[model samples]
Target chain A: MTGELAIKNLHVQIEGKEIIRGLDLYVKQGEIHAIMGPNGSGKSTLALTLMGHPKYQVTQGTISYKGQDLLALSPDERARAGLFLAFQYPFEVSGVPLSRFLLQAVKARAPETKAQSNGRPVRRPLGQFRKLLHEKMEILKVDKSFAGRYLNEGFSGGEKKRVEVLQMLVLQPEIAILDETDSGLDIDSVKIVAQGVNSLRGPEFGALVITHYQRILNYLKPDFVHVMVKGRLVKSGGSELAEELEERGYDWILQEVGAASTESAEEKGADPDERS
Target chain B: MSDHEEHLGERKSQGVAIAEKPQREGFERDYNKYDFRDPEQYAFKAEKGISRELVEKISAMKGEPRWMLEKRLEGLEIFLSKPTPTWGGDLSELNYDEMCYYIKPTGEESRSWDEVPDKIKETFDKLGIPEAERKFLAGAGAQYESEAVYHNLKEEWAKQGVIFMDSDSGLQQYPEVFQKYWGTVIPAADNKFAALNTAFWSGGSFVYIPEGVEVNIPLQAYFRINAENMGQFERTLIIADKGSKVHYLEGCTAPTYSSRSLHSGVIELIVNEGAQMRYTTIQNWSTNMYNLVTQRALVYQDASMEWVDANLGSHLTMKYPSVYLLGKGARGEILSVAYAGAGQHQDTGGKAIHAAPYTTSRITSKSISKDGGRASYRGLVKVVQGATGVKSNVMCDALLLDERSRSDTYPYIEVDEDSATIGHEATVGKVGEDQIFYLMSRGLSESEALSMIVLGFMEPFTRELPMEYAIEFNRLIQLEMSGSVG
Candidate 1:
């Protein structure tokens, strides 16, 4: 189907070793999709490849966003083209306060304001930006102090994950790729994060939520659930697929696909790079 | 075939070759803004070299007292005897006799901008000194080459027994005060550069605040070097008397030249009993400069002194602003920031000498090195014997932008007293690929992301500056970061 992100036969690698052998997925606006997989699977590879990460080499693939070839765009261009990624491990940027970073990011995406006279981007009025940031912080149950803190410098695991979602909320991209955003968070934080994602749900917004558990899906209620195994989507179904996988585990699906033996071998010899 | 004459020939050829080459468009634009040089207009230019005769000529020109002239001769002797420093940065390339010791840009200092010569005034106008003074400064002075061409103080501050003017005028008008405190904090014999400055010093600021008075606004002085092969030796002395407060700022810039120049300044401060003083310096010399400055402050009982220094755009710089806590319950704080781009080396830090009981001091330094540049933090903290209850902490952080850049920390701590407390911490970090990628994914260009990270790194130092200076500092950082990204 035509979608905001349409990946077809995508092959990706890192450091000369293939991680995503071949993958195909489509995420349309006005829809939410979740990809669940066991350890050693290439869930993060797909997310990073979608964002044009330099380390993730796409050997053979076609990713079209809004009918434009996404591979040709730089990472920043992809972001400016209404694409966002919530990293599983967000990097720490020391000294940059969260509010200031958000403001810069917002200005980078929005059209140049009329007040810009010197060719430098004029920031949104401080009062208006502060009001919006505080409102978003409140929605995520984040404390006010978070706005003044260095980005992810000394933040707790839950805070980092929440802040990733918070950035998505402030930036308000058309499509988001959440890479294991709920892995280390508590149940309450999981609910809050999901609620934050839900706030941006509309006909103009779509999301590809990558997670290991079906817990966040319970609150997200994605339109489709896909099972990713050995760097490819093995199956796609409704939300029940996640619940079924949660109860039965991936062993049943592995046996059904007749790749259980290879899966076990790869799992035993899992490339450490995939986990990071 | 003396070393000085040989180097002068080589420098002339190199300058011609550089002028012949095609300039990069972007760099030319940036360079022309600060590197434009007017014709070499000078009232007098000292002969290239430093000798007893030259020192006597400088003294004779200034018409100094017999004692002062004798001091200059002594400084000249000491400067000749001492060897050039070997550590910190490379100073072997410097030729003592290749530099013009002094260039008197104007015959007399002007109290009003209108009276200043049009050529010199144009330079200051381009540097925005007058505008800054009109907006926020309590007093302002502009120095060209070797002389202060313009100096003015607000009438209100002048009415409160505040003395602000160029150092030459200060010596002439307040010889008693100058004689009492001159060279006390940083004696000429302390270092080779200090001795050189003492021997041939020209334009700098001299400020004094009376007891129980406060100058809430900053007094600023801007120094500009106009001619190639010029050496600027500015001597500044500030006295904040008992129960007084004052803040003074100095900024320096020089036109870009293919041949190297020298800037050796000596700044001495006296924070008297129960007084407070802050001295801020933002030195952005051209990349062809060797900036060696000695700055020190003496803190009396219950007094406070602070040094906020930022160094940028020099081929090599060695400066360590020091504080001597000389009385009980005195405090000293130093905040230093350095940025080293391509072909630059910023060897800068702070020194704290706790000599009295209950004295406390803190030094925080942040440096950024990029594009094959080197930044070194060389610091010293010494607490003498019997200085009980003395406390000091030194924290240094360095950020290297690429693999080619380098950072080093050399912290020397000497505590003779067992009762003193001291702590030193240093961290060196590179701009991580993950950090850059994360910022880039948020729609910032690579350079923009890098500059943002650097600006954030320098926040502690910038936040302490006045609002306008903070803005200007950020803009300078952004300009330095542009074209740095590969």
Candidate 2:
């Protein structure tokens, strides 16, 4: 129960349209969970909702982190409570250097006791912070120039994903939600990102990786693999489940779970009569 | 000028004494560091009005030369004849007769901090001026109200024939040199505000660097306005002789008052052949002040001039620092940043004029508006005829924090030369919701996220400032960004 993120019967909506319907998940401190789903399965929605995005309206759910009500906290509060999210489509914030942003985030995440008497967060010494940053960048194989460049501005898709992981390593959150971070990465880049994540693997770090393909799981080696369809998990298993899905597509699992794969049917032109 | 007498009567009936009551509002809360006012104490305070008699008295009080007195009278005539410009922020509410034209805080200037009056010295101590001077400044000058209370140059620089003192002292000590270069770059007929400044100018830095002398450290001047309904007109003139190099910095602040105040200043610089000059200003007036200023420089052959200006506070500000390249291969650069919060309108930019062949210049402006504030960039780039091989670029970027805020760009480019190269770019953007959410997800508060974005937008300007100033400017931006989120 300690250092655990528990979501029970979670339902989320966007603009009065239901997205996630009755999704339940529990991630402990020392576990790595992978959610594999096709397009439009509410994978990214779950990630955003977990981070308390303004756009995602939670209709019914109870999210508890470390025995506290996470729903009552703000997005920044949730982050300071040891949660992180690597966005599926990271927004480019021009003008802010990556190192400067990381330093602010690290300061904001410090405990209240570390704050000064004026109730302002005390900044970490520049030399110490730079040392930590350089070490993390080296682990992610990021060039030195990346630290001084504007955050995510003009960065390639692969660079963006690596920086996301790079941020996670620096922040060292207890639970990180990676939302399709490997969607647009090459095989080599995927391995580098996985290595960056693996460097943080321990009894104190947990990750919920959302992906459509099994390519990244080959390197991440998650402890649990759950097949998500339509909004909720349908089948939960081990690494072999991922290999099975890679060998044969999600059609067999969709039929076994009795849920129609709307995306696949639409692609194959088999759902002409169905209205979206 | 005749109509001001009627308004002066109305201002008295409204009880002008209450203007010094120090009304604390939400806007003034964040500016507490600069909002603390000292008790009004002055050796001589001019009556609240401006006229021929008042201008003559100001010139006579300084015991200036006959030519300077005649110049002041002529400036007064021009100022009274010119109608208020309607193109910039509203100046209809500015009352000339309701403001004290001059207030002499101390009888004489002191070369050491200990000799300064205790009250004025305490004010500068609170502002951290003396400590800053001891740390890195080559020389420092402090002006309180309409007089320079303290001014001193390090003996090393002073021994090298480098002159750094108040403009009044410059005229009295080096009359020949001051007379030779005074009003040469920016004349009284340049604009209405310049004319007003020329008529009532009192305390500003006059710096002169001898030929072949390089003052590696910067000379700084601090200006403070204390009384209510006070108009401060400081005139600064800097001359860098051939093969000389120097950097000058100025900062201004005022205490919060109920009634409006006016600050109109003129700064002129002459960079001789192969000389280098950099002038920086950080103007942070109170929210109840109207800041209208004119600053220009004349660069000679193979000379360079750079202007780094940042405007953070004022109810309305209209300023455009310009550089005129008058000789071949002259270089000019201007970097400006403006931040406008609630009840503020900042109309600021830069101008570059190429008057000779093979001159190059660049102008970069960045502005941020939040909470119904409005910021506009009004700039000009002119290349005259026969000024061939001239290259110039202008860039303006504005960031609006909310839907209620506004930003505009008015870029005027006039190119008469056929062989000139000119480039202009402007962008207006809002702080994206996605960007805020992304930063917030990484453990930063909303205000912190917004301030980071703004500081980033101003990196080009901050990078040109000294390390201490960059830190102070960042702190000021952070203060402005705090409690900005609703």
Number of clashing pairs per prediction, in order? 0, 0
Q: Which sections of candidate 1 miss by over 4 Å? A: A1-3, A114-123, A261-276, B1-35, B107-153, B223-231, B252-260, B484-486
RMSD of 1: 7.0
lDDT per residue for candidate 1 within B1-486, as digits (tens), equals 012112323434443322111113423343433343334446887788878888888889888988889888888888899877656677777899899887776533313444333433343433344354421211112343323333334567778999887888889999999998898888778878888888988878888999989998787664222221123888889999999999998774322232237888888999999999999988876676788888989999999999999998667888889889999999999999998777778888988889999999999999998876778887888899989999999999999998877788777788999999899999998777778889999999888898999998999999888887887777668756876211
Put down candidate 2 lDDT per residue, A12-100, tens digits, no spaces. Answer: 88777677889999999888999986667777788999999998889998999999999999899999999999977778887688998
**Which segments of candidate 2 are over 4 A away from where they belong?**
A117-123, A264-276, B1-38, B107-153, B223-231, B252-260, B484-486
Clashing pairs in 2: none
TM-score of each: 0.87, 0.87
lDDT of 2 at B320: 87
